[model samples]
Target: MMRIVTAGYSRHTRSYYSNQAHGLKYFLVRLQTEGFCQALVNGTLYTIRPGDLLLCKPGDSYELMVQLGSNEPPSGDYFLSVELNEWMLEWWEDYKQEVKLNVGVDEMLISIWRHLVYEKRRVKDSNPDIMDYLCRSILLHMNRLISGGVSSNPYERSVSNQIKMFIEKNATEPITLRDVSTAVGLSVSRASQLFKEAFNQSVMDYAIEVRLSIAKERILIGGSTLQEVSFLCGFANYTHFNRSFRLRYGMSPSEYRRQVRPQ
Candidate 1:
């Protein structure tokens, strides 16, 4: 089971305050919807603008500094944090190969995110399954553009097609490197290596990402409880779900529901 947790949006007002320099932390995916900020990772400065995404790995020294840009107040920037658990690790691998940071938001992703924002606003408590489904879809939509490049390498194209088919065929099953290997007619280790090379993710890692993505939908839209969702989603137990969910959202499953539920 992939034990990932997510943190929802909580806006922070910045008047040019400096955060204390800290050691490396968990993976940080910064989505800039408004305003601009700069992140200094080990003396290298990177600028962030609207639609830009930034990744920060744990244990890496970094600092976040925000300032007022052309826009006044800059209060609408959205920042979310999710711990990169096993499933995320796989997603990251594929993502690193296929997607580039700071790329403009694809129309599909924009639509999904708009829906998520709308849903989040109306519900005081959210169904864990629904939240998971929506969030996972948002993430995948962002990655799909990265995966669908114009490259013509036969091997890369093959890998991409296989992955797509695999995801569609087994949306409800636990995806495994071994399964991909068998489907692709390659040794397990060889399959892992090629997948990492072409998609920037091991077969197992991508599998977890797919499973998590589907589980989120099943739980949320299917109206399944955490236990049922976990069991059906390929998690070993509820404890595993709690840990992963907390890490990804910065709140437990129950808390997420309470936070998103309409009063």
Candidate 2:
């Protein structure tokens, strides 16, 4: 699993410098949020402004330089020291000596980072896992920024893709084991076994989940009545839709809509 050894946010004024560089012991990320910042990444000087990030491996030398913006008291930056899992390390190895990511100052990433710093100080919060999730999110977002797209895990990509596509495309209509099996070029028994192994649920059960998901979107949109929702989501009868919805979400369709409505 991925790990964030430590993280913090800080600010600096003009004329601050560190002549001696610490020996690299952890993967480091320093992101500038305001004003101007600079760093020598892999022996090249870079002037990083708001939303620019610096990434370094375990053995690379790094240094920070910051200049305050006009009307701003100090330059702002956030730092993270991380321990990547084996797969993540392998992913990192594919990059060059130094990489710069331009994420462009996202609010969600800022919110997540603030919460992570708050949780780090509250030792009794009993929610340490939030930091791990947030750190992973930041790293993934940086990867997206650098790579120019999102990437999926290879193991997850290899599992029951054809069956899932068929279910999503046909969830509004009647679907069957024979149809799915034929589409995937597998016998019905073999298809059933493979789907179960990959998704831990039978094909029909996943189909219901997909259908219910569609119904939920429609319900939340509030452009349809309960009767329309039942038929539109592929339920044979309104009573069956009500029962299945209650079983999965513990509320009637109408009740769910009300609960999720904006206050």
Stretches > 4 Å off in candidate 1 = 1-20, 69-76, 95-100, 114-124, 148-263
Estimate the lDDT of model 1. Answer: 0.59
TM-score of each: 0.45, 0.53
Candidates' lDDT values, in order? 0.59, 0.73
Clashes of 1: 27
Error of 2 at 82 (Å): 0.8
Per-residue lDDT for 1-263 in model 2, tens only? 55777788988866455432554667877788877767875677888777777777777777776655556567788888877567558767766555676655555567678777787677676365777787778767556445432223222222355576678889988778998989878899988877777667899989889999999999888878889999998888999899989999999998998898855
Best by lDDT: 2
Lowest lDDT 10-residue stretch of candidate 2: 149-158
TM-score of 1: 0.45
